[model samples]
Target: MTSEEFGAAPTRGRRLRTVVVFHLADVTGPAKSLRPRLEAIARRGGGLDVLAPAEGSLAGAYGDLGTVCALPYASLTVPRTPREAARAVRSFARDVGLFRRELHRRRPNVVVVVTTALPAALIAARLEHLPTVVYVGETFPSRATDGTVRWLGGRVIARLCEALADRLVCCSETVARQFVRLGSTVTIYPGISRIYAEGDRAGFRARYGLEAASPVIAVVGNLTAGRGQDTAVRALALIRERLPGAQLVIAGLPHPRPIDEAFAASVHDLASELGVERSVVFTGFVERVADVYAAADVVVNPARFDEPFGRVALEALTAGRPVVASAVGAIPEVLRDGRDVLLVPRDDPVALAEAVSRLVEDPALRDRLVAEGSRRVESEFGEEAGIEAFEGVIADVLEQRSNGPRSRSSSPG
Candidate 1:
């Protein structure tokens, strides 16, 4: 469909209300990333109908955005055993009937689902003969010790996304490649906020008691084994030999999962064992990630496993700092090696340290990387892309439906 077709949607006398459903609790990473796009939908004489599970901190997560209501999905905040997972699935099936009733009552033009919630939402939207767009982030679950049940469940969810959804939008090209079964897919980077693009470097350093040239190296994200914080600490042990006063900053919060907290403690213990304990700082769960990026001379996203998108690397680049990251998953698709970012081998502390050292020693190299990174981030991942892409998909679906009724078995092209 042409871009011009997007703006042709009717929104004069009456507004087009949009409904979005996701199985989530609280305003975590995903909520924060897509909230801007939701606001944009609201700005175009449209409304946001948020349908999430009523359990946990969801009430606070969506706080006064659109018309918030509850769907009977499973709660992650509660103890999640295999039995609980099954119960949640059964509950979701039950909720589908209620949610379909809500859609009919609300009569939204389209439905948008944020990832795995697609199965139930798609089924409900189909009952109402409404088109759906599924926003896919991680195709598979990421955990250090992912039991077979969760992994198998993720596969089931992925298949449902393929079989039921009309259009599947991916968070990055990597995700698009891994999940292009039957639906037409598009890539839209959930760009970082303006605070990262314009944070105070000097002030952030001061707030953390960092000297003007202490050479801070930062790793930002949840404390997890797959994220590779331990590797960052080992790299710091290597970084300190060259720049003795160099520090490693770990900025993130641990999840309620025991493994997540245990992983955080393991990272700290590794630092001590390496005799770089004093140089490493663990800033637990700071909301201000841009500030963490600001305090760093070099930022690292050393993900051991492939990720859908390395958001921390994006934030670091937005903060105008040189970034060193592993060439895993969709990271290379977003940031180029030796251009916007420096890519290293996964789980190699020696390689990680060498890359960080190069940025520290070579001021000219850092400047080259920073300039390229800023330009790439601006042109490619601009503020409006997320909202615009979503709007275009919704518009396309509406326009197609206006042309004729879609066959129930017809796959999206």
Candidate 2:
């Protein structure tokens, strides 16, 4: 069929087969964030194939999610020095071969990629004339804990990805702003999948042996620096004094850097010193996150630096938990202060502690915040909204390709 013939808007029931590629191995927020939507798409009997850099459990986790198929390539770790660029290229070549094989088999209508590991997929999409969407999370090195050299490398790679991607799908407007800064066409606010249910809470809590009445707080995402897990740990210590029985859940992957081992040890020591170590549970990377949300009276995302977009904040809201996130990056866009969530300044452990304490002490305030947070997630970022946003970008990209190139105009994003 001609591109114009397919230009008619897709109806709600239409099945759209798509291929999503992101070379994330092991457990991390972006992988967790993308899985649900891919599962949903798969359940609709549409083709869904994921290309990732993971083996074992990560591969197995995606396998069980839905009809979507998972291909686990040996993950490419960030290179240390400019001299390692050749090694990085070789790694990318290997991943591209895997992706090409998968694409040849699936022949999906659209291509979606989260990270910069899939320039070949972008090229393939261009060659095949298939619509392509690139979901840019916090770019490497920028999001990495490394300093100047890695940052420079990250910028170079990011520039390459920007040049290749047909359309950029940013996790938040803040991330999209970066692409817009580079004169690229982009969409803001990525989608969230609703895998966990409200009814699953009791079972999940029971499994963890959490007390029925203990005030619970959860921190979801990878255990990395700048993510502010330590801030949450300290906040938990301070919270114990106000709400003596408060329990904190630190979930998701452990810290990515070995240097952070001392920091992790310090957090453990701090917890023990506060005498609330027993109350603080570090449940490393739970498969079913809905339960974590269920067992919590409040959710905290205290990322100490700019996160292109904080996915966990939306996840917490989707799970109907009151979120207290740092007022950094795109958080101010996702939540309202004293309404959907309690926003505190970044890097202030005291502020994080006080917010947790306030929420724990006031039940009414907690309830209101949770309700508002849920409403906001449903209204702006729920499954349907996310799907529409994604599909809209695809439609726009396809339309643009069909219309031919025009003078580039600055987009406000």
Candidate 3:
């Protein structure tokens, strides 16, 4: 799609009624990143109705924006057993009926599905002939034990969005590449607040009980195996051997899933086994995550999977910290190996440790990476730019719907 297509001004003097659907009820990264976009919509004389699985922090945060409703929906999952397959079918059918009823009651002009995990909303919106936009940020699992099943399920969801939704808004080019056949795929990177650069380092260190002279390495993300918190913990053991006062701060809470919970426990156990428990601090669900960045000498993102977009790296860079991240997915796309950030092999504790240690020892190198990384974020991924792109997508989708059927000459057969 050309810039002209999306740059068309929205119809003036008409309030656009929009309904946004989300799969999760918690205040997740995607939900937080989307807040500014939703606020922009409201500012543009748009009516907002937010839907999620249940009423929780997400609903409460968006209450002022518009009406917040609890609508339980089923997400697509790879079924490994016969029982799971049967359950998935039943849940999907029930969710489609529920979503259809909700859409009918609301009668929105546009339907926005926040994640590809939930396809019931898209199907329902297609049936209602409402313009739909699916925002995809997730990189489906393709390297796990059930890689084949998970990969197949992800392709099915991708095809569903391509066939049903009027537009697909991807968080990164890495994600957009997966929907190569979708004509309306647009990449809009999520933005970070400038507040990250303004955190109080002294206050954060004081509150966390860390000495001013100690070297701190922070790994910020939910506690999960895919996030590679265990790798960081093991790397901490090696890091402490050189810099005895080095501390690893594991930030964020465990997701409310059984696999994530177990992974979190395993990370703690691994820290204990490596005798780095005392040197590692676990701050569960930090309200002000910038503080963790402020208190850190270096931030490590040792992700084990193909991260769709490494938001943690951006946040760290925006906070003026040098990042040591895995060379996976969009990380390398946005950050350079030695210039903006250090890229290490995935799940390699030795490389991660070595990179962190280098940052600790070389102040000039750290300053260079921090400067370059922050500059890139300011120029390309600011909040205003993201909001503009998002609003453009919504406007374009609405315009197309108003003009009747869209031209399929640009789409693949």
Clash count of each predicted structure:
1, 0, 0
Q: Write the per-residue lDDT of candidate 1 for residues 294-351, one digit (tens) a residue.
A: 7889999989878788877877887889999999988888899998899999999999
Q: Give Cα-based local distance difference scores for all models.
A: 0.76, 0.70, 0.84
Q: Write one digit per residue (lDDT tens) for candidate 2, span 1-413.
A: 33443344554444667777765556565666566656665676666666654443556767664334446554445577767868777766765666665665566656887776557667555545566777777745553456777677667656766777777767777766655346465645655666544527778678777888888888887666777887887787777777778888887665455856666667678788777788878887687788888778788999876877777877877777778899987888777898888999987878988988888778899889888877777777766666666656766665665555322222212
Better of 2 and 3 by lDDT: 3
Q: Give me the displacement of residue 397 in model 3, in angstroms.
A: 1.0
lDDT tens readout by residue for model 3, 311-365: 8899999999999999998889877789899999998999999999999999999
- CA displacement after TM-score superposition, residue 346 of candidate 2 (Å): 2.3
RMSD to the true structure for each prediction, in A, is: 5.6, 6.1, 5.2
Give per-model TM-scores: 0.83, 0.80, 0.93
What C-alpha lDDT, on a 0 to 100 scale, does residue 7 get in candidate 2? 46
Scored by lDDT, model 1 comes in at 0.76
* Candidate 1 off by > 4 Å: 1-14, 26-29, 54-65, 68-72, 75-89, 101-106, 141-153, 403-413
Model 2 stretches astray by more than 4 angstroms: 1-17, 25-46, 56-78, 101-106, 123-131, 139-146, 181-183, 191-206, 255-270, 273-275, 402-413
TM-score of 2: 0.80
Name every residue pair that clashes in candidate 1: 252-285
